[model samples]
Target: MIMSHPDSIPLNQVLPIFLQVLPLKEDYEESTAVYGCICNLVLSSNSHILSFVPQLVSVFAQVAVSPVESHEVKVHIGRAFSHLISIYGHQIQPLLGNLSPAHANALAAIAP
Candidate 1:
């Protein structure tokens, strides 16, 4: 229901695109397309995507730690994390308490 807003559409669509990239190791072109979309989501307005932060970080963390994920995908996730930290870290920190202190501390440091 909350995702029905026009402003949220771009952010809402990012997860599926990221999924497409995460599972496809051999398709550089396709992966790049999805990663670009994810980058857009990262930079999108937090008010539009505030509810989706946990989903975004969980997916990115899953991919970030996955050996099966492509290096390119991992790189996108890293960038996404940076964007999330810089843009929405305060909003996302509670959801990320499951992560180690060092990583959580780093994210907290980057958060507004």
Candidate 2:
């Protein structure tokens, strides 16, 4: 819904829902969907989603390094992460700096 009709759906409401589902251990498919939505939001150039970037970064870092997650999930996160870096590299660097060494390294390994 967000990807197809971003104007009809307010991000403030949808983002909270995404944040809640993204960290679950039992739902890689749903988490992958969320990452896809986030990647779409980033590519769409929606400035409203910018405020949620920090939280997304944290979650993306966690998911990227999770041993139980599927390789497909990591690829989705990598897409989102790459979009984030290309568009928000300056802001993202500091946030990445705040991640644990393992998390930061995982993200770096996926960087394009």
Mind giving the per-residue lDDT tens digits that candidate 1 earns over 28-66?
Answer: 556555655554556664454445667666656655554
- What's the true lDDT of residue 33 in model 2? 72
Q: Which candidate gets the maximum lDDT versus the true structure?
A: 2
What is the Å distance of residue 7 in model 1 from its true position?
7.8
Candidate 2 ranges with C-alpha deviation above 4 Å? none
The lDDT of model 1 is 0.57
Candidate 2 structure quality by residue, lDDT tens digits, 63-87? 8788887787678777778888888
Q: What is the lDDT of residue 74 in candidate 2?
A: 77
Name the weakest run of 10 consecutive residues (lDDT summed) in model 1.
1-10
